[model samples]
Target: MSVLDFDNLTKRYGRTTALRELTLSIPEGSVYGLLGPNGSGKTTTLGLALGVLQPSGGTVRWFGAPATAATRRRVGALLETPNFYPYLSARQNLQIAADVKQTDARSLEAALETVGLAQRQREPVSGFSLGMKQRLAIGAALLGRPEVLVLDEPTNGLDPQGIADVRALVQRLAAEGRTVIMASHLLDEIEKVCTHVAVLHQGQLRSAGPVAASLATADRVVLGLAPGTAADVLRAALSSLPFVQDVRPETDGRVSCALAIGHSPASLNQALFAQGLALAHLEMRHRRLEDQFLELIKN
Candidate 1:
């Protein structure tokens, strides 16, 4: 059974529909990234999935059944900015949270260790940096040993080093065999950390798949031919290689083709030379995640 499933989930705040019949399934062991622009319903989906907000229509299931009071304990979430007592120490704050959640001492210890906060557990919250505070919040979410961790914009408002620290911590948590559901506008973070991605635009799903395949939508092997090289000759040469696809002539006398996954641009160039047309230039343009993200939001 999938870790989480949203079945035609829809949400409306009176006249404003936040989500529109969205359906998705998150498998076990996936670091799932929920991606979209500011108002594309990423947060709304998380909220509905966590039962923080009631959906206007549809159902959310956890581990093959509808979410219930018991099901929520299996998932942990850190949405928006976290709050802790300024005067309280990190350990104290977590102890309070643990008391509220009924988490035991062993679980709390494991949680602090997972986020690398055990060394500073006794330090006051006022002494912690933004990244440290974020880690503490994640540590709190780890209470009760939840199987799935849900984080919304977890890296927001941190310095570069802090971002790196949190990123590493997140990677470690996922390595320990926990499914992670994260919502973020940062494509780089998603690309670096997530195994699966679901993109939303205008409250609708634009695409969903493995991160590599999603970003590899149209990776091109750019071939700039020598002057006066006929486009037909290039097309004819490419025809012999079935893996070369979407062959088109550029206005500047360059020809570009989609290289099949696992095939490098060097291999494509070698294939072209073997076909007896060795002329000018060959370059590989690996499509950027941001470029793919923009295209999704644009359409």
Candidate 2:
């Protein structure tokens, strides 16, 4: 089931259209990433879906219905910077958040432990690292055990260790059977943690699907012939195969081509061998997510 759906959802600010006709459905139990560079409407989309900002056009639905107060309660969000009293302990901050949410403090212990702040719950927020504070903020969002989490650039300004902490925390949250919708400009972060991704550029949807499938669209199978074999012979053989496409020569004296749908590297190798051409090297060059992201937004 989709935890959230956006049907041609759009947001405009005066003369500028921040988000345009963004239609997407976030599947339940999946870690969905909104991938784009700055000013690409990632935040605008999140704001519209969370009801923090009214859409200029279209609809935002949560759990197949309009976002009501009850439905909003089922979603936990860390939209921007984490706000906490500098002098308050982590536990105290969560207490304040609970009060704001009108939720009981009964779940504080579990939330603290889940974010790995139980041991340091008593430490003053001023003494905690940025990553710790972020986790504490996430703990606050966990006050009522929401079924979905929405995080925007959860690792935006952290050191390597802090980024790692938040990444691990996100993974842990998804493992507990909750849907996590994260927005980030970092291609590596999205590629590493997201099960599915939607690429946005200039407020328009570029591509959306399972991460592997999206990247697979650009994958190529590289073929290298024996040292004595003429390169033209290899190219000629590839040109004759109906399943091969985009045949190109690599600078390293090797040939690369994309295989058609339902075809595999093993099948390609078998087909080449049947044509009396033995391959000295054959490997699948899986395209990086960064390459795919750049290509999507380049235009």
Candidate 3:
């Protein structure tokens, strides 16, 4: 069943339109990604869906009805940078969250443990680092044991380990049958955690569907470089190749570049070899979520 539905939802600010006829459904128990560049209406969409902003032209339906208290109880969101009382300890902050969520206060410790903040629960939020604060924010969102979790740029200011932590937590949530919707500009992060993705551009949805299907729809091309050249040097040279769309350098002197004009792997290698580039690493490279995202935005 669809846990969240946005049907022709539109929002505006003065003369500026923030969302344009957005229509999508997030199925229950799936990790959905809301992907777009800055100012692409992702936050606005989340705001409207959470009943924080009223739509100007359409409706956001939760559980097949208008967003209401009952529906809100099942949905928890960490929109933008989550704010908390800096003076309060993590446990105290979560106590406040429990009150707001109308859930049992005893669940606070469990929520803290879920986000890996159990050990730091007594530490004041002010002394916590940015990553710790993010974890606490997630704990607050989990206060009610919500069936649906909505997080916007949850990894915005974290180090590698923090990012990994959040990613693991999200995966664990999805594994446990919770519906997760993440709004983020980090395409790689979305690729790693999201099973489905919605791409938005200029206040309009460009695509909405499974991540694998969207990635497969993208054109693929491979370029093989001669041996002896450093990967960086080969990447720079191949990037200058005609129709070469992107270049990702791997370990060793191996580089893969996608061609804008979709061609078979063999054809790509033939073209490169014709240009005096030797064939060492020749295989079709899979398109990353960022590649598909940029393609959507550009078109």
* Best candidate according to lDDT: 2
Task: Mark the regions of model 1 whose C-alpha exceeds 4 Å error after superposition.
Answer: 85-89, 113-132, 239-241, 250-252, 261-267
TM-score of 1: 0.88
lDDT scores in order: 0.86, 0.90, 0.84
The digit string of per-residue lDDT tens for model 3 on 1-299 reads 99999989999899999899999999999899999999999999999988788889888889889998778888888988878999999999899878878899988878898878888889899998877888788889988789999999999778888889889989999999999999998888888999999999989999999997777657454444566665665566566667666676565556665555455667666666766667666766576777778878995
Give the alpha carbon lDDT tens digit for every residue of 1-299 in model 1. Answer: 57999999999998999899999999898899999989999999999998889999999999998898778877878887677997999999999888867778678788888778899999899988877888888889989978999998988767787688778867887899889999999899999999999999888999888898976865877787788878778878887797888987876777788877788888888888887889588877787888888988895
Worst 10-residue lDDT window for candidate 2 reads 156-165
Candidate 2, residues 1-299, lDDT tens digits: the string is 99999999988999998999999999999999999999999999998888889999999999999997778888888887788999999989999888777788999999998778899999899998777777788788788888999998888666787688778978988999899999999999999999999999999999999998888788999999988778899999999999999999985679999988899999999999999989999999998998899999998
**TM-score ranking from best to worst?**
2, 1, 3
**Winner of 2 and 3 under lDDT:** 2
TM per prediction: 0.88, 0.92, 0.79
RMSD of each: 2.7, 2.1, 6.8
Model 2 ranges with Cα > 4 A deviation = 85-89, 119-129
